[model samples]
Structures are given as structure tokens and as C-alpha cells.
Target: MSDYSIRLYVDSDYEVTRNLFRNGIIEHHNKAFHHALQRPHIWLPALVVLTLPALNLVSVTTSILVVLTAVAAIWFYCRYMYTSYVDYALSDDMLDISKYYLQRDGFCFWVAETRGGEVVGTIAALPSSDPGGEKHLELKRLSVATKHRGKGIAKVLCRTLIDFARRRGCEAVVLSTSLAQINATKMYEKLGFRQTHSFYPPGLLGQFLDFKIIAYRYDIPAL
Candidate 1:
């Protein structure tokens, strides 16, 4: 977009980028909450609570309270899930972008900035962690500010990573997205990425709640 430009991240961009990362990930909690509500394990009990009023097994007031409680629980669970991820990320590579990405060969982080120099988006690429996988780059932390979206910022950021991977002799680029990020998943598909696999997030809570994360790979074509 004419209003924005892409450039490598710097120490001065830390606060804005950190806030962007935190807010972007946490914003999906509502979507996850609604998604969870649609699951049988989550909603069935709420459904039973709703039917209690009609079946005369519980007063209407009591049934409403039960349903409300279930909804609140689902919301809290979704909130916890997203916040936990944000916490882990903030403490990981994000905790020191320069040391983890800038200083490493075949690894870098970039930000999309407004003409006025505000950091509105971020993306990073690093060598894949899988043992013996030198030909793959892992894309991470792709986020564009809400108001600045829909102007091709995300697509350009992704293209930047792909180009970087190509230059690094990487055969493909890989990334992971949560099920809550439906729009992102669709965009990746449209960009020619294929679903490599899907898995629930780590931890007993993630497994018990059945939250899913999808992995995608984009093979670089020969120049």
C-alpha cells in the first residue's frame, strides 16, 4: 500500500510490535469462544440446561443461570487459551527479536510501517526447527493492525518472507495458524500454500478442549 512500507525491525519498534503481537493474538478469543460453543462437548450441557425449563426439571431462572454459567466458562477458557499463547510468545523469540532473529543467519524480522513511521505489522522468518531440515524456513508473527488491514499489507508481508526464503535457498516456507484464524488460513490457501498437517495445541487443556492448529507449507518455484 502507498501509505505503508516494509523494513527490517529495530530496537525502537519493540513496544509497538510487542503490543501488536499481544493484541492481534488476543483479538481472536471471541472467535474461539464462539467456535467452542458449537462443539458438542461444550454446548450439549448448555442445551440440556436450556431444555430443563421446558421439562419442568428446573425453574426458568435456574435454567437461565446454568446456561449463562456455561457460556461464561467457554468464554473464560477461550480467553485463557489465547492469553497463554501470547504469554509464551512474548517470553520466547519475541522477547529479544534482535538476538533471536537479526543476529542469526537465515533469520530476520520485519515490520510494516506507515509513512509517518508507525509500526503497523510484523513478520519473521527463521530456519526450520525440524532436525535435518535445512531447506525450509519457518514464517512467524505475521500480524497487521486492525485499522490498517485490507490494503494488501499481509499479502505483501507474506511475499516478503517467501522472497527471503527463496534467496536463502529454502525449498519451501512453513507456518502454523490456529483454527480461530479462519481468514488467515483462507489467505494462505489462496497464496498457494498447502495444508501439511493439523494438531491440537500442547497441554492438557488444549487437548481436552480440542483446539486445533493447522500447519501450512508453500513451496518456492524456480526463478
Candidate 2:
């Protein structure tokens, strides 16, 4: 892998990470049209996990009625924040991470094609309910650009992130998706991710579950 090197963004990788954050997020919203604009992101996984399920399951219909209201509530009460927590684990020195980043499209799309070169695949991380008692990662998005699909690129990316997270002390990495991207779910399964949970987007569980963590633990040396 001498020719291929994975760049870690932290405070040092701030600028680029920020760019990755901004461009990627905006692109995501434009296309998917989902997320808490104020803070649709899950900054506190455990709190969300606990409070949400504990929230009365409600009449199944009541749950339906609660959807837009919850969306409106979150839109006003939350704000989106980007992170390269893995990057922070990569270095001991304080990093200026806002610069030297990539966020052109969505991160899944961006990293899949950085430097205007061929990008085979992509993975997006988000928050998940912490039933396992640790902050988790959800695959917010995963895509293997059409030209590069069917190759092992997506696996490579996921394996790389798994290794990165292991070294960084992350208990797990997670993500959630719907019919819109069934292939992504399949890829995650190939990589050993079992669905701890699933739901219709904009559903109650959607708010409760943030990151979709895979079941298997991957350990590989980081480059």
C-alpha cells in the first residue's frame, strides 16, 4: 500500500476536515433532504438512545403523528457539527483541523474521488444509540461510485475505518439506511455488520438510532 496513504484529519487536519464537513453535509441535504438542520446530528448518543426508547412507544398512530413535530422540534433545537475524532486519535499534538480537508460532495462521494483521481468507494459515519455503553459510529452514508462498484473498494474503505477506529479506541462504528440504498446495507453486511435496529426514515427510531455499528471488530495496522 506504499502508493496509497490514508490522511488523518484532526486539529492539524482542521481546514480540510472543515471543508469535508461543509461540502459533504450540504451536498447530503441537497440530495437526501434529511437531517436536523439545527442539530439533526447526534452529539450525545447515549442520551438519545435512552430517552427515546424510554419515551412511551406511543400509540402506533401517535408515533406517526409525532414525526413532523419531532422534526420541527429538532430543527429548532439542534445544530450540525463535524468531527474527525479518528484524526484526533492519530496524533498527540493539537491539530488545526479546519483546513487541509475534503468535503466537496458528501464525504462518501468526496473521499471516493479526491485529487480528481479515480474514487472507488465511500463511507459516512454518524451516531447510534449506545446500547453497548460507548459512543458509536453509524454509517451515515456509503457509496461506491458507479465506475468503481463491484470491486473491493468499499470493503477496503470500511476495513480501513474499522482499523482506524480500533486504534483510536472507538468501541464501534455504525450507520442507518433505507430502501434508497439497499446496496449499502448489503456491503455493510458483507463487512460483518448486523443490523442492531432498522426503521422507516423520519420514523421515531430514526431519531433514537444515530450510528449503525457493525458487529465484527476489525484490527489492522493503520498506515
Candidate 3:
């Protein structure tokens, strides 16, 4: 917040912004891994493995092998999911920022630059899925570097997008965040965003997992 100013994204800022987003997701992933490991669901698999040996349904050696396999599978699954998300983002809007963001109507990307010319944060606003109804705007890729946290950079970035959307006659601003981002959720709430939808991937795997993505919407007042 000292000498930093938020400005529209440019071609030269693409690499820096992309890397910042990648690192931000990785930071959340690591925190989520630790939080998930502490949950009862992770322990349930081990509990079943231990109980099988005690109940004589499986031999001790077999029980140990099963536990090892389950642990390995869980580890692999988490890493795979994280990698998939990163790859998709890289190939999507982040791949060609100008095409997906800059060139689109009612879409814009912004990056926060320091007095020394370092990009420290980014945020964007894009047309909502239902553009004809309610005139919505979706805020995307809001992130600030770790070293720049607690300095009001994120708040500035968020406000910048919201104000921009308001000026364009948007009725509301919408965004989504995963459960892993506890702090971000709180910040959104503090910014007057209300929880609108809770989402999770489909299928049996999703039912068994604790993963959830929560959507929030901020109703904009007429300017």
C-alpha cells in the first residue's frame, strides 16, 4: 500500500501475474493438505485397516499393506487434482491474457505495481454467465503475493474490480472460493458478499471427499 498502484494488466505483466496465481494456488493447496490430513475422513481409512487386523478378518501383514496402499492412493489423488487445476488455469484465461481478458467486452485484468515496478497482485472482472439477466460481473483471479499480504493490496484489488463493475451498470459482482481459502472467504464476507451457492464435483468420489467450493455474490448499489 505504500508506493503500490493498481493498473490495468499489460502483455509484459502476464508472466508475473501468471506465476503469482500459480504460487497462490500452491500455497492454498499445501494448507489444504494439512487441514485435510487432520480431518476424520483421512483417519477413517486407517481406522478400518487397524480394525480389520484386530477382528481377524485380515492378517497383520495384509492390514499393514492395505494401510500403505490407501495412504499412497490418497497422496497421489491430492497431487493429481492440484496438478489438473493448475494445468487447466494455465491453458485457459492465463494462457492468452489478451485474448481471454483484455480483448473481451466488459472484461478487464488489473495488476498492482510497486514504485519499483514489481507486480505484486492481480484481479479481473468478466461478464457473468447470464449477461442478459441481472447484468452480473464475475471477479476472477484475485491474488496477492505472500510477501505483500496484510498491506491492504488485496482489498484495493477487490474494491477496484467492484467499483469498475458498478460503473458498467452491473447489478452484482460474483465470485467463488474453495473451503481451503478460509481467510479469503472471511474477507469476501467482510466486503459484503453473501454466500449464494455451495458446489462440489459430482460422483461418488465427491461424496466421499470434503472438498467444497462456495460462491458469493455482492449486490451493487446504483451509482
- Using lDDT as the measure, the top candidate is 1
Which runs in model 3 stand beyond 4 Å of their true positions? 35-42, 55-62, 130-134
Q: Could you tell me which residue pairs clash in candidate 1?
A: none
lDDT of 3 by residue, 1-223 (tens): 8789999999999889999988887667655555556678787778888789788899999988887887667666655556678789999989999889989889999999999999999998898885464589998999899998888899889999999898989899999887888889989998899999897766554334556779899999875
Quote the positional error of residue 133 for candidate 1 in Å. Answer: 2.9
lDDT of 2 by residue, 1-223 (tens): 2323334333333344334433433333222223333233543432354455457744545554455566554443222211232234224212322221233211221234444443334454433445773545444334444544576666766776675456556666765444224466677777777666554334363354332222322222335
- TM-score for candidate 2, please give it: 0.42
Give candidate 3's total backbone clashes.
Answer: 0
TM-score per candidate, chains pooled: 0.94, 0.42, 0.89
lDDT of 1 by residue, 138-204 (tens): 9999999999988999999999999999998899999998899988998999999999899997677
* Model 3 TM-score on a 0 to 1 scale: 0.89
Off by over 4 Å in 2: 1-110, 113-116, 126-133, 203-223
Tell me each candidate's RMSD, in Å, in order.
Answer: 1.5, 12.9, 2.2
In terms of TM-score, how similar is model 1 to the real structure?
0.94
- What's the true lDDT of residue 70 in model 1? 70
Name the weakest run of 10 consecutive residues (lDDT summed) in model 1: 201-210
